[model samples]
Target: MKYALGPILYYWPKKQVEEFYQLAKASNADVIYMGETVCSKRRMLRNGQWLDLAKEVAQTGKQVVLSTMALIESPSELRNMQALVDNGDFIVEANDFSAIDLAKQAKVPFVCGPSVNIYNGSALKLLVKQGMQRWVMPVELGRDWLIRLLDECSNLGIREQFEVEVFAFGHLPLAYSARCFTAQSEGRTKDECETCCIKYPQGRPIVSQEQQRLFRLNGIQTLSNDCYDLINDQASMGGLVDVLRLSPIGIDTIEHLEAFRQQNDKDRPFPTPDTVNGYWHKLAGIRQSEDEA
Candidate 1:
């Protein structure tokens, strides 16, 4: 399976974001997704900045895709999506339906983001009709369900026309809300509050009373505490998955990606407390069980 570097989900300094992508250009990745898919308030890199980065990365022979915000709460956000669709340089990953419309208007081939809630082959077919070239299955679905869906897609005759991508790594994006938790953490309301998420390079990790990591607080986004690791299943992944997405994290991401690239055994380096794949196995999302590594 091809490896894809997913859009950076955390808030990073402008220089740091630039440097990160520079380093990623040399990494063992085939596809690079650029753009701010999280909060609109986090503008470390604006449209021009992201496009410039995408241009630079594309030079390294990586297929670049511009990703839209998963939470588009304002008209301005819709306009931003329109701008990306109109750019006409790279493929657009439509995270929200508003972006899908924009892609349709632009007559551009688009990748369906995981947040779009495409569950069945019919919905997938509908999106394909709208010019979706690839679709990311939702995070909560598991192996058996995906096999069933793939079987259905085979029967439907349009399966060969679509690529299937999976969010194989990173903290799971559990939920999003109109309320901004980063602001709430600072004793401020979401509306009038200053953008405080800029301070936390990685979203604040919420820990249990016993100091066990529980969840991550990223503006309005809630993510699983454990880093979602799929290196163990890389070979098997090729059969069911077209691309494996490694979500951006603050610490040791390059190292993690390198390890994943070198690993061939499913149980090589055992995953640590900071990593888990319970959600992928259809078990409790936080369960930290593992096979012999």
Candidate 2:
């Protein structure tokens, strides 16, 4: 299977964003997803800047897909999604229903980001008709459920029309909200907040009373406390998945990409990545199989 780099979920400076994509162009990720999937208020790179970056990245022979904001709160965001779909130079990942409609109207083959809840065989088939060529499995779904979904797709005979991608690395994006948690934590209103998220490139962590990390607070998106590692489980995806999406955290991203590549390319077994894989095994989202043992 090949690898893909998911969009940057945190708000960062414009220069850091540019430099990150430059490193991504040289990494082992087969497909690179761009644009913002989180808060649109954090616009370090505007719409024109993102499309320009998409053009530059596409020249590197890597498949680039622009991602839409998961929660489109305004007409401007809808227009942005439309522009991304009609860009003609790259594919767009439809993160919301409006994005799906935009891409369908444009008659372009779009990708369904994990945030878009595509669960069963019928849903997959319908999206395929809507010109969805790739679908990333929802982060909370396990292997058994995915196998069933694919089996149902096989029965429908449209399995080959689309590719299956899994969110295999990085902290899982659990949920999003209409309220900005970061701003609330900082005692600022969402509209007037001074873009406090930019000060936190990796997001602020939420810890329990015992001081264990429970969640990560990006502007409005709630992510998992720990990064996920599935580099060792490559063999299980042989017939099920076509691409593995590695989400971008704040640090050591290319190194993670290279490690995944090495693991996917060889059989000697690379060193373990100290992240959780509980959700993959169908246990509680945070409890690993060994944890129960």
Candidate 3:
């Protein structure tokens, strides 16, 4: 199937963000998602920057999708989401219900980001009615759950309306909150935090006293300790999944993307997971089970 580069979750400097897109444009990703899906305060590359980049990359025959923030705090954020929906050029990935409404009102086809709750067929039907073109599978759910959900959608007679994409790489976005954990970790209140997350390009690691990674802290978002990998599980997605999404992480992300693009090659080697796999096999998300892949 096709490959998609998920939006950057970390906050990098404006120049670095620009440079990253240049690399992304030359990469093997068919679809590239860009925007600040994490803390809004880390506005190194704002919405304008994202749209401009989208246009620049789209010219190379690559599709671009602008992603909205998961947690909308103020009216400004809502306004930004509305603008993203009304952009009229690039596709927008709705990370929240407010964005879904905006896209519905704009009559713009959108993608339901993995953060949104789309557990069953009924919900899928409703979103399809709202002009959703693609639906990203939630990171927590496993293969069996997806099978049942697709079956339900098929029974509803509307399974063909949208493409299915999976989070095939990177740290799983577990949860989001109004509270900025990164700020808290630095002993600064959310308002007085001074955008401390900018210091962490890939987010700060929350390690246990035993020097084991417990979780990753990024503003209000709580990420999995170990980066969840599912490249080897691509075979299972045959006929079921249309797109494989690789979330941006590390300096060698382009190399990883190329490796995933050539996943069908038997001689091609896959990147080793920093820690372990997630719930794709219905096991503990953070469990580094030696018995499993």
Candidate 4:
């Protein structure tokens, strides 16, 4: 299976963002996804900048994909998505339905992002018909459900058309809101709020009353409280997933990528984390536990 470094979710300074990818190019990641995905207002790098970065990454022999914002709140964001699709140099990851429409209209083979809610065989077939060459399993969907979907595709005879990707590392992005929690926490209005998220580069951590990390706050996005360490599950997920995606969190993601590359067990026990996998199991969405394997 190949490895893909998902978009840099946090807002880093422009130079730092460029530097991170430079380091990533030397890493074991096979595919590189770039562009602003979380908050459009956090524009440390502009559309042209991302396109340029895509070109630079492509030079490193990594297939570069430009990603769209998950939540398009304005006309400008829509236009941005259009431009990303229009840019002929690389493929685009359609995060929203509108992005899918634009990519189809452009007649480009696109990747369906996790937020698109693709649930079954029919949906997968329809997406393939609409020009989706690859699909990312929704973050909350588990192995059992994924196996069922894959089996359905096999029975239906359309399994070869799409590559399945899984979010294997980093803090899972749980949900996003229209309201900016970072601003609210700082007693500022969403519109007028200074980009407070800039301070907490990886996002502000949310803790419970007992001082346990319960979640992470990134502007309007809520992430898992425990940093997911899935290096051990790499082998078990080998044949089922085509690409293992590691969403960028901090500067030190190279080690995580390397660990997965060197793993050996196909049904290896998952590495224990002090956070919840509730969202993945269709459970509480915040319950934490260690899988005994």
Number of the predicted model whose lDDT against the real structure is largest: 2
In candidate 2, stretches whose alpha carbon ends up further than 4 angstroms from where it belongs are 265-269
Over 1-293, each residue of candidate 3 has an lDDT whose tens digit, in order, gives: 99999998987788887888899989988999988887778877777777888999999999899999898989998988888888889889999999998899889999999999889999999999999999999999888899999999999999999999999888889999899999999999999999998888778998889988878998899998788777767777777899989888865787888877677555444656455665888888886444575
> For each candidate, what is the lDDT?
0.82, 0.87, 0.86, 0.82
TM-score, cand. 2: 0.96
Cα lDDT tens digits, model 2, 145-255, are: 999989999999999999999999888999999999999989999998789988777788889999999898899999888878788778778899999998888548878
**CA RMSD per model (angstroms):** 2.1, 1.4, 1.6, 2.3
Error of 1 at 127 (Å): 0.9
lDDT of 3: 0.86
lDDT of 4 at 181: 88
- Candidate 1 vs candidate 2, lDDT winner: 2
In terms of TM-score, which candidate is stronger, 2 or 3? 2
Which of the two candidates, 2 or 4, achieves a greater TM-score against the reference? 2
What TM-score does candidate 3 reach? 0.95
Put down candidate 1 lDDT per residue, 1-293, tens digits, no spaces: 77788888888888888888888988888888899888887787889888988999999898999999998888898888888998878999999898998898789999999888888988888888999998887877766678889989889887888999888889888888889987898899998667778777667888889999888888888888777786776665656788878888854676677777677545565455557776567667776446423
| Reference-based lDDT, residue 115, model 4 | 74
